[model samples]
Target: MNLYPINAGNFKLDGGAMFGVVPKSLWSRTNPADSNNMIDIAARCLLVEDGNRLILIDTGMGDKQSDKFFGYYYLWGDDTIDKSLARHGFTKDDITDVFMTHLHFDHCGGSIQWNKNKTILEPAFKNARFWSNKDHWKWATQPNRREKASFLKENILPMEESGQLKFIGLPEIDLLENSELGFDVFYANGHTDKQMIPMIRFKGKTICFMADLLPTAGHLPIPFVMGYDTRPLLTLDEKEKFLNMAADNNYYLFLEHDAHNEIITVQHTEKGVRLKEIYTCNEIFN
Candidate 1:
């Protein structure tokens, strides 16, 4: 099995919102903000080449939204999904599965694209089965007021409409169970419902994908939860548990939003599970 980090691109998000109550004095040191107070974030995706199956985890925001709509989040960078795939000798057609961690636009938008005529939407990965949980699917489709803006219909509906949606239910081991991976599913209600973090096993080490739970290495502290999370206290509990486990087991955390740090290892210190080391994924995989 081979895993590749797919760089969809980069975008800007408010640093305050990204790091809840954490004072600017702290987070700004690591993720320096622009004059507008927005920090750069990576729309990083993961590609897994497992035998005959080519699975992609999280598609970055696609280029289908109107300029007005996209004006809100300033997308930048030269690296695109196409170029990133080409870097690894693959293409959209080669993806057999799209495992979405959640349905926020930045996570799943790249799964579909505008058709040739630019009149309608079509599956971006023409031949892949898009995977999302049934419960989260319903929640995202019929989004609540707080999260409605983030769950855009253009980024979601096309998957089910295209007849390529698959559900990874609760109990299936080989299909979607937490035990198959080195880490267990520590579902948190804070950052949208049922946000699944894949506790991955790698070469005698365990690494986890910190989707929005810990967006960046700067967010390692327990209370630095994002304001976007529905239930902040629930997020605190989830982080406390997960980070403790990660420190105890020496898990390497893969950050989705951090522009600088690719992977971080944490150690149990007097201050808590503070970051032990920051290294690029290549340093580990190679």
Candidate 2:
């Protein structure tokens, strides 16, 4: 199996929001903010090439939102979803599965697009089976007030309407109980309800997609939970357990939102589990 890093592009978000309660004087060193106090973030996605199945995880924010809506998050970079896929000599039609970690706009917004009729929305990958959990599907569709802004309907509804949407597995199971998808699902609730983190078993090693749970290297600390998380305490618990396991087993964390680091390994330190080594995906795999 081969894995490719897909750069959907970059966008700007408030450093304060990204770091939560972490003091600016500290986080600013790594993620320097602009005059407006917004830090540049990468909308990084992952592509899995296994046999005939080319699975794309998390499509970056698509190009369908209105000018006013996009004004808030300043989108930048020339690397688009199509161009990124093409970089690997592939296209949207070659994708057989779109494994969405969650339904947030930055994560799944590119799953759909606007057609010739401005009013009509359609699946971005007409031939791909878009994968999301049943519970997450409901949570995003009938989103709560706090998360409603992030779960845009334009990014979601079209998949089901196009008859290409599929649920991975049962939500209540310890593991993703009914997920027909081949990968093992690590259920994490700290970021959102039943956010499925895919643990891909390849070449006798486990590579975890650290979707929002550990957004960046800076977030490895237990207290560095995102303010956007619905349950911060639950996130603390999940991170502690997951990080301990990752450290013990030497799992490579494939960061989704980290602007610089792509993969990292953690070691149990006196302070806590801290980053031991930072390397790109190919460096470890090759």
Give candidate 2's root-mean-square deviation (CA, Å).
1.6
- Of candidate 1, the 10-residue stretch with the lowest lDDT total is 174-183
Q: Candidate 2, residues 52-77: lDDT per residue as tens digits?
A: 88999999899898999889989877
Which whole-number lDDT from 0 to 100 does residue 157 have in model 1?
95
Residue 9, model 2: lDDT of: 84
lDDT of 2 at 151: 95
Number of the top TM-score candidate: 2
> Best by lDDT, which number?
2
At residue 154, give the lDDT of candidate 2: 82
Runs of candidate 1 with Cα error greater than 4 angstroms are: 171-185
Q: What's the lDDT for residue 97 in model 1?
A: 89
